[model samples]
Target: MKDEKIVGSFQLMKSLNKSLILNTIRTHGSISRSDIAKETKLTPPTVTNIVNELLEEGLVKEWQTGSSSGGRKPILLKINSSNFYVFGIDISPREIRFAITDLNAQTLLYKTITMKEEMTSSRLFQMIAKQLYIMMDEACIELKKFVGIGIGIHGRIDADEGSSGFAPQLQHRNVPLKKELEKEFRLPVKIENDVRAMAIGENWFGSGVGISNLVCIKISHGVGAGFILNKKLFHGTNGLAGEIGHMFIESSGLKCSCGNDGCLEALVGSEGIKQRTLNKISLGYKTKLIERTNGMIENVNGQLIYEAALEGDLLAKDILEETGRYLGIAIMNIIHLFNPERIIIGGGLAKAKNFILTPIQEVVEQRALTEQAKKTEIVLSKLGDQATVIGAVALVLNEMFSVQYESVS
Candidate 1:
């Protein structure tokens, strides 16, 4: 009976504390103890207890007193913005994206370091560490003030073991990334698939804000999808849910690096698109893309193709449309299977929204089931390239809040 009583009281405390903290400022805006009690249905004593704890934890701050209501003025309480920061990194093949963010995940500083030449997992990790150190130093932020560190990678992840289970791009499998980073910096580290991180971040701060069911498809050097189902990041069994890139979109077509043929990535990835376009133009294809690119057909990406289309380059425009149509085919399948409420397009290639989105939208509008299609809204990701890094930070915050609950309750 004694143990049960203690457990019941602890459970009550958890529910009440979370509600009071979230509701206090929510109802009254900038509220004080007296107002919080009046608005929350919580006793003045209980409100007082929780507010004091929040103040000490730097979660809330007391501002100046409000105007007198012909009685003793109440002290104003506001959410503290600078209490702690979540550091995030997106370790992409082309670049290293990093950000310093406050408690609410608002970025304070953003920086990118390029990987001009070769990229090895070990070397890239060190580069990331170096860039993070520089970012912290430049921002004059002490390591202690950082809530946590999060790194988003492109490929499968073993979330439980905190390792990169198998990343063809990174050429590392089951690498103990989180543990090694945590040991090096003395900070808790979270590692996740880049698309998964983006989905979480988008749900928290971008296109999926307030939406529970959505998909964020990133089209870059590679293509990937991140899903949010039942208001949570859904990584299926064995952490291999969002490998949309490797799925067979072409039965016996272009070979993918994953020992597969006709993966969606092979048909639309930057390298693939560039190779195909360069080959066509070099063979005397008549398109404004060549002249715009100064006739240099070394390597073209979706962005360049989009630029040409926007500039009325006929071949470039057609290429983008074709890719978008293929995307439509793949995304149509995604819609049919998962039936998401929203489809958010993002990535380096999404910058070519003018060229890619319209064709994809057209196909979806034409082919999808009328009822499901009507329910789903397709749009561009507001965070764009920053989505990956911001999502990484969201991973850290999720871990931080969960740990806080563990400690408090």
Candidate 2:
């Protein structure tokens, strides 16, 4: 028991040290061993030994030497961002988006394969595997350097088992996604809620990199949030913590995809925006949208509405204002609950930046609790469409490095 405890302690310490050294190199771009030791507060010998191990593993490479003050130039070390690759797949309703990313979560190659709406999860996963292999072949990335596969799916997932629990958009139940993929590819698999995976990505490499507490709210066909609390992805009990889309917004509103009445998604999602515009058209409201969509109500979508708004159409702007107001209510609730330092808005709706952001901020400033509202900064996501896919890559890297979750300041 004494020997076992000592061994475990040693292993933990070694892992922590390795993470520190690698992270230092990653953040500094190229750093000397002495600088790494100073940044990580590890001894020079410890840094050298760990860096040597990383060098042997091909995770780190020696770059050009740094000039010394009065002695021999010191060799600089950097993370070989290209040495290893992680494959990420985003499984949405009508498409499977695949990306091969380097260690830094930068996309090396990206491809999307559209799928039939009626396909089964098994069939989808099979296609996913095929597309990944094709991408790997095209990129000339060997399987040996592939870290693992990270999958982001639309609905609630049993992240531990890599199985779906409830995926209304997917129309699948209890699919053993991780098991099937792992079996087929013979590589480890990590599955996460698509938005949560995006949050993880932001935490690692995007806008939330240094920011500790933030929420990435996605508004598209559905509404959801991925939280980075205290610099770690917060998967609440059952991994459903961030389903803000389903939050009760209206007691008697439209039925959501989740079968909930008056959910946030039902009010502000892509379909919801279209429906609201149609409602206005039905009420005989005059707008340029009639000309914009050629008098076809069915043609009015979120993008058209934003375009109309940008063209100075009052009705379209009003609809967006209403959408932003609803989103603001939800964000106020988010502020009251999480009190995050930053709230990142993404998804299809986020494209209408000023149209949505201004109203949401207006409502938040007026309605949210004074203290929380004052502390929070609402912003749009920088990752854009690549958020979830790159986030999936981040999942693999975080796992391999065993990222240390630091407390938010």
Candidate 3:
């Protein structure tokens, strides 16, 4: 009985030790074995054993040592970023962007596909596969070297079934994107909401790198958000925790795409901005916009409206003023509820920094409880368009830490 107990304890300790080594290397790249041991609270011999196993699997590599103190210089060890590549695709209503990246989230190649507003899911999937094939061919990547594919659709993703739950942009419901692709590529597959993917990218390598409670809000094509609470991606029970777009602010307001009235996204999405501006222009709202750009609806985005406001376009300025005011109302709600540390704005429309952010900051300060509003900071996403792709890569890398998340090959 004592021998049996001892053997079981040994196995448990070995497994725990292996996890520590892997996690240490993941957080601190190019760390010496000694440093890893110190950080992971592992014996040097145990770390060496795990490191050797990982090296044999091509997951870790020993780098030439940099300068050290007078004592013997330690050989630097790092995760082999080139051991395999990951494919990430962001499929939107107007465009599908595909990128191939190494394990460390460095882009190797990228391609884009443009389509009409009302397109079918089947055709879109085929186009995506074709584009991905071309990108891989251009990059000269062998099929075996690619570990798997990750797709970021601009909707809620049920990754367990590899389906897009309610992607209004795709005009399809419950499309099993990853499952179908897995059959064709013969590799593992994962799908995520684009907003959540952006948050993942930030969590790994961007502004949210060290922060715990944060929000990544994107306001292009539509307004969506992803949340990081206590350093973990908090997906509510239905994977819809961060679906703050439909948070009701106006009960008698215009009908939203989600069949709701007065959603935050309904007020602030690109469509809303476009419609509001055109309505004002049609109603003889005078502004320098006509003289400035010669009456071009083509030139009017949320940012253009901000610029027009700055350039003395009364109509454009009014749009921003109202937009900022509404945004603040929504932010006040978030502050009271989440009490987060930071709210990082991303997406195409966040370009109107001052016009959008100032109002939001003001509203939060005025409306929200003082202490709650003080905790959050509204800012921009540094990764920009790269966030979704980088986040997809981060998703795959994180799976290694999960005991149940399996590999493809």
Candidate 3 yields a Cα-based lDDT of 0.72
lDDT (Cα, tens digit) per residue for candidate 2, span 346-377: 88898999899999999888887786575479
Q: TM-scores of all models?
A: 0.81, 0.88, 0.84
TM-score of 2: 0.88
Tens-place lDDT digits, model 3, residues 78-136:
87878778888877666777889987788888777677653455665677678878888
TM-score of 1: 0.81
For 1-409, candidate 1 gives per-residue lDDT tens digits of 1223222111232454544554457434587777777776778888888877767766678888657878766678886758778789987756778999986788899998887864545576677778788888989988777767888877743344355434442324315566456666767677778888898888777888878688999988788898887667777765667778877776645787666888888878887677668767778889876666775767556766877787788888877887888788888889998889898999887888858888888888888887667447888999998999999998876554432211110
> Comparing 2 and 3 by lDDT, which wins?
2
Clash pairs for candidate 3: none
Instruction: Choose the strongest candidate by TM-score.
Output: 2
In model 1, where do residues sit more than 4 Å from their true spots? 1-47, 63-77, 116-122, 156-175, 279-284, 402-409
lDDT by candidate, in order shown: 0.73, 0.79, 0.72
Ranking by TM-score: 2, 3, 1
| Clash count, predicted structure 1 | 0
